[model samples]
Target: MSDTRATTQTVRYRERLWVPWWWTLPAAVLAALIALEVNQAVSALPNWVSFVVLFGVAGAVLSWFSKVELRVVARPGGGTELWIGGAHLPTSAIARTAEVPRTAKTAALGRQLDPAAYVVHRAWVGPMVLVVLDDPDDPTPYWLISTRHPDRVLAALQD
Candidate 1:
């Protein structure tokens, strides 16, 4: 038997671009129509209902700006990796891989010490697995990663 592993290519860095609010035009229209029809009923509904509706609207607006944009490139057999937005980092400096959960808190890479970060498509999108690095000489010590395919991305990086 022969070991036949495919040639390893550099994992391209991709910039996760935020989907503009305009992208939700259809959603807004739908909401508006529903709201118009439900306006009368809204008053009859419990106060909690209004709260939920408000949260829904706010969540939608936030989602519009939190979409992930990524930049990926061939690994080039070295530590250098460029983000889709043109940011670069060295894989050699990677401190560890932190598995992020899929939730609102995980969106936009929440504050440090936060185990999970939020992205635009928190529930719809795959959970992010951040590559924490030690930036001994810099203030930034971690990378916000929202790879399209987390398991595959992790596998490629491990290789």
Candidate 2:
């Protein structure tokens, strides 16, 4: 018998994308209007109260959707890693792998909005796989991961 031991069990890639305030202008405008109405009900509140409340809500919304990080790793022994956020999933916990296309508006606007310009443009561009993990406690059963440069992350996971 041979002796083999594993060191790291998981490897994840996490990144936060930056969203410009202007991208959220429409939502901000609506939030500001609603805040004004609420502020009027609280007449004792200062004039800056509405602005603070409006911005607070806007900031919260922006913060929630500002960034996306993708984590890809190898499973222990012969398993896959977990990927959350967007679709909430795991590599080995899935059966089917598909290419998800970006909506026209999202694509057009995203070109300008994507600071990293890592948008998935072509159908063949995605070698993304869906994993099906065996962990019952695990939440997601499937994860979408890029096939391009899979080794870069795969090697990282092995290390």
The top-ranked prediction according to lDDT is 1
lDDT per residue (tens digit) for residues 77-141 in model 1: 55444343335555666777756656633454545444432222344455666777766865665
| lDDT per residue as tens, model 2, 1-159 | 012322454455443343555757877788788878878888888867787878888888777664444555455676655443344344444444443333333444345333422232223233333233455665544333443444444444334
- TM-score for each prediction? 0.47, 0.45
**Candidate 2 weakest ten by summed lDDT:** 116-125
lDDT of 1 at 6: 16
For model 1, the superposed segments whose C-alpha errors exceed 4 Å read 1-68, 75-77, 80-84, 103-126
Poorest stretch of ten by lDDT in candidate 1: 1-10
Question: Clashes per prediction?
Answer: 28, 13
Cand. 2 Cα-lDDT: 0.49
